[model samples]
Target: MTSTPTTRNPPTSTASSLLSVEGLRVAFPGRRGAPAARAVDGVDLDIGRGEIVALVGESGCGKTTLARCLLGLVPPTAGRVTFDGAPLPRSARALKAYRRRAQLVLQDPSGSLNPRHTVYDVVAEGLRIHGHAGDERTAVAEALSRAGLRPPERFFLRYPHELSGGQRQRVVIAGALVLEPELLVADEPVASLDASVRGEILALLLRLRTELGLSALVVTHDLGLAWNIADRVAVMYLGRIVETGAVEQVLTAPRHPYTQALLSVLPEAPGAPVVLSGEPPDPSHVTAGCRFHVRCQILAGGEAERAGVADACRHRELEILRGGDAAQVACHWARAEQPAAGTGDAAVGRRPN
Candidate 1:
């Protein structure tokens, strides 16, 4: 499980970023006097024009909440989200205009599509709402064609129940495409489809980016999907980004303890999977200092003692720090050379006895 430090190439400048989120936070009030649940805690992110960035994490890590914030579907407790160098729209009229440029592709096509509506109606609904319905037929057919449903008119009058799972998903994408959006925030876009269908949908997304020059923020728990399509990867833990870098670098040689543990478990991983001992921490009552310290193999294995940073790992809050040329890791000991095999009892990158 040993890995060397690697450099990360930063994304384009803020002015050039198609979408930017700074210090974003979202919290829900807790019940019974408990602390508020912080779904997204101080996340900062940027997506360049035509870039596909995958937000990867386990369920409940707040990837969806972060996406919602970017979509203006949920209001953030704090922080700012911007598009094309301007703050998100506030008034109803302005927001409507903003939404036309940024659309969402949901995870479940079956649940998202109205069973009663024809495909034409589903795709044209956005055009009608945005005042582009005058040429609805043309726009609907074009969008459906762009989504890989060639000869789109043939399916125009078909209902959701009549389409294959893949075609239904394409209809959902067609609905988003009808708006001619510049940015698409797709939340687990392929999770519900068959494995065979998953590749088709992903290829469509990439084609849209190449042909239409669209940028996207895809949220998912599957690291393989990120490797397949995303240009960059942001690994989320709890509500914060713990590691982010170019997809090849982050997936091949992750820097964060959490990232390493995750990759170690992949089927073709180099070593026996590194298994952490506890469940992920609750967002409502996040621990102080490094949120992952309680389960970190390096700290648990006493590598921190060797580095003389054990105290810092338990008390001092660590910021997202540069670990290599292109990678940023949020850990006090990330830069330390990997501990020699059998160095500590931490089980950081070792199989269970």
Candidate 2:
């Protein structure tokens, strides 16, 4: 059962956003007469300069795909990504330069690091590639220090196999830091470390943002992590952001049925767990209307029936609707309650399939 939830003041961010993604979509072509798989579909997001935004969702919901697109590791099938007012460059040379300004930290340090390369070599590799290796030793040492590995010289000669899990992860972070990137897209940065080490790594990330003025987009399924660090939260479901707002606002008073169901499972939440009826819909075979209606408790509990919108819930597509000053939710019932906040009357209208 969930516990009572206490309200916290909403997180505030004054910095201007540096990364903007508009209507991003990524589709993998299928084989043997199957339909294409849509990994990321019509996602819109923004990360403020010097801010930390958490991308929270279940597995296969496209959090990592969205992060990879921002890093230019995966080309989008549609939409555009802009950094600091300019679109992502298409040429290899220009893209390479862009990469140096935005680095990625993978989830598994053991798999991402080279067993053959020492800590110093791993960190200095980026510098060498970017022609900034005039003082390789000094650069590597500084990066290690910044990543919370003190007495950087002591770790310089140690290889991946010789270090602890946490230390190896630090080395991976140091490699990203060597480039002095403005944005860091970390995919589950602490998922592989020990419980004791997780806080240390998260603390290191917070410190980096504080001391270096870095912006980050952390992709994780852990809502606790979002509460612990993010200035804002974006909730993804079936390849779209169904809810987004200040971390506290979204977590404490979630508006969408999907977001509410997720929060209801938290140990400290003040109700019984909202057990979803079935697995998430397959990306290649998404439903016609509200993708979440099949598993939504609110709809099943008679919200749609009471409003005479049950038929619409099963046949009409829903769009993200704004509410109050800082929340957005995509649900027919939510839209009906706050009609003035969304678009025309058609915003909640039914579409026959």
Q: What is the lDDT of residue 327 in candidate 1?
A: 47
Q: Model 2 Cα displacement at 201 (Å)?
A: 1.1
Q: Any idea what lDDT model 2 has?
A: 0.81
The global C-alpha lDDT for each of the candidates, from Candidate 1 onward, is 0.82, 0.81
Give candidate 2 misplaced runs (Cα > 4 Å): 1-15, 320-325, 337-353
lDDT of 1 by residue, 103-132 (tens): 999999999999999999999999989888
Cα RMSD of all models vs. native, in order, equals 6.7, 4.0
lDDT, model 2, position 119 = 89
lDDT of 2 by residue, 27-52 (tens): 98889979988888777777878878
Q: Candidate 2 at residue 60, lDDT?
A: 90
> The CA-based lDDT of model 1 is what?
0.82
